[model samples]
Target: MQNDLMGLDSVLSQISDVRQSVTDMNAISIAPNPLSNGAVGQVSFTDIISNAIRNVDSQGQEASQKMTAVDTGQSDDLVGAMIASQKASLSFTAMVQVRNSVMMAYDDVMKMPV
Candidate 1:
């Protein structure tokens, strides 16, 4: 029985190692995205902001749909619904924070007695 348990542990360890290796490979497969010098000519900050806002809006909509599913008893996973709601809420809060920081910085710059 001791040998059996050791064999089982060995198998589990191998499985865990394989899983980590796969995850690492996936991370390496996705090349790093750097801001190119010509990126401004191709895509402005407004474009990036607009894209991000659109994505956040889409996520919010999906979260609402997930919530609706839960309310209608269509979703079996309440945790999944809750996670979606939290993600949407966090994304929205982040965007609001970003906006507030930018506004504050602009006000500070304007107030500079040059």
Candidate 2:
């Protein structure tokens, strides 16, 4: 029973770690100097979205690795794996929600009063 609990703790810790890592990735951004506007490609919404998608993709891959580790029994912390899995699931859901909202917004814009 103690071992199981420890495993759970480890899984939870891993989940937290993954969440933190993903947050860190998303927090990164690049800003263009507004003072000098002589560029072929200036900062745009698409660039930000592309970076965000890449970060999310990497986080998903890391979560998959954690799950695989747990399934292989190579990781002695089942609890940590469980937590990580749950966190990953939640993040994925949130991303889906964001995508849905963006699409809806785009559609609304397309139907705006001209």
In terms of lDDT, the best-performing candidate is 1
Off by over 4 Å in 1: 1-41
Please provide TM-scores, in order, for all candidate models, with all chains considered together. Answer: 0.62, 0.56
User: Which has the greatest TM-score?
Assistant: 1
Q: Residue-wise lDDT of candidate 1 within 1-114, one digit each (tens)?
A: 999999999999999999988877522233334755433234356877898899899989999999999999998878998999999999999999988998999999999999
Candidate 1 — which pairs collide? none
Which residue pairs overlap in candidate 2's backbone? Answer: 7-79, 8-79, 10-80, 11-79, 11-80, 11-81, 12-80
Worst 10 residues of 1 by lDDT: 24-33
Give model 2's clash tally.
7
Model 1 residue 49 distance off true place after TM-score fit, in angstroms: 1.2
What value does the lDDT take at residue 42 in candidate 1? 41
